[model samples]
Target: MFSTRPRDADAKQFIAEQKTLASIDQQVDAFHAAQPTAPDPVIIEHPIDPVLQTGDSQLLGGAMEIKSPWSEP
Candidate 1:
């Protein structure tokens, strides 16, 4: 046995709160849409790190030589 006036008031209050949350969500989405996104990373053909290379590094002109402690000199 519930009164109709109180039920209507509660429904209206819930709808208003939901609309407020929806408005805040829309604002946040618009803010992110206005910001600029980062650029994609540069692609490399080989595993060489060009940024940290020096003059003594071997270029991609020929095959790289790997020397290990187990290999004879």
Candidate 2:
């Protein structure tokens, strides 16, 4: 007769496999819901003017300047 609780290696392995199968099924369901239905394209405009560009070197260089310690107090 089988015990109320699992008592053998085969019973433990069966429980583990069942849990693994359940986890895999949950992941599959999530992935199916996350599937993309259509392709989306990104359109961007690149500026040609050197100084007028979004991240010009002059602007970023000045932004990195260390301020005076006296300004903190």
Candidate 3:
């Protein structure tokens, strides 16, 4: 009787866990459905040219300084 009680308790816990997982899955599905689709990319006729090097004249061993466009000041 003691062994059966533990087994029954474990079974109930497993069922409860499964129900929680199912609820999460439903919420995720609903969220996905509510999201908007991505828009198409636009094409331009003439794109602006990118700057290759910095205007700094003084440098060690004549090495050019490279800078990233996304870097913050």
Candidate 3 TM-score, true structure as reference = 0.48
Best by lDDT: 1
User: Please, what are the lDDT tens digits per residue for candidate 3 over residues 1-73?
Assistant: 3564677889899999999999999999999999986544443333322343335522222333343334345
Candidate 3: worst 10 consecutive residues by lDDT?
A: 57-66
Query: Model 1, residue 61: displacement in angstroms?
Result: 13
CA-only RMSD, every prediction = 14.4, 13.7, 10.3
The local distance difference test score of each candidate is 0.70, 0.64, 0.63
Please write out the lDDT profile of model 1 over residues 1-73, one tens digit for every residue: 6675777888899999999999999999999999987555543344566666645674653334443334345
Poorly placed runs, candidate 3 (over 4 Å): 1-5, 43-73
Model 1 off-target regions past 4 Å?
1-5, 46-73
**Which pairs of residues clash in candidate 2, taking residues 3 or more apart in a chain or in different chains?**
none
TM-score of structure candidate 1: 0.51
For candidate 2, lDDT tens digit of each residue in 24-60?
9999999999996543444443435555545655454
TM-score of each: 0.51, 0.39, 0.48
Which candidate do you rate higher for lDDT, 1 or 2?
A: 1
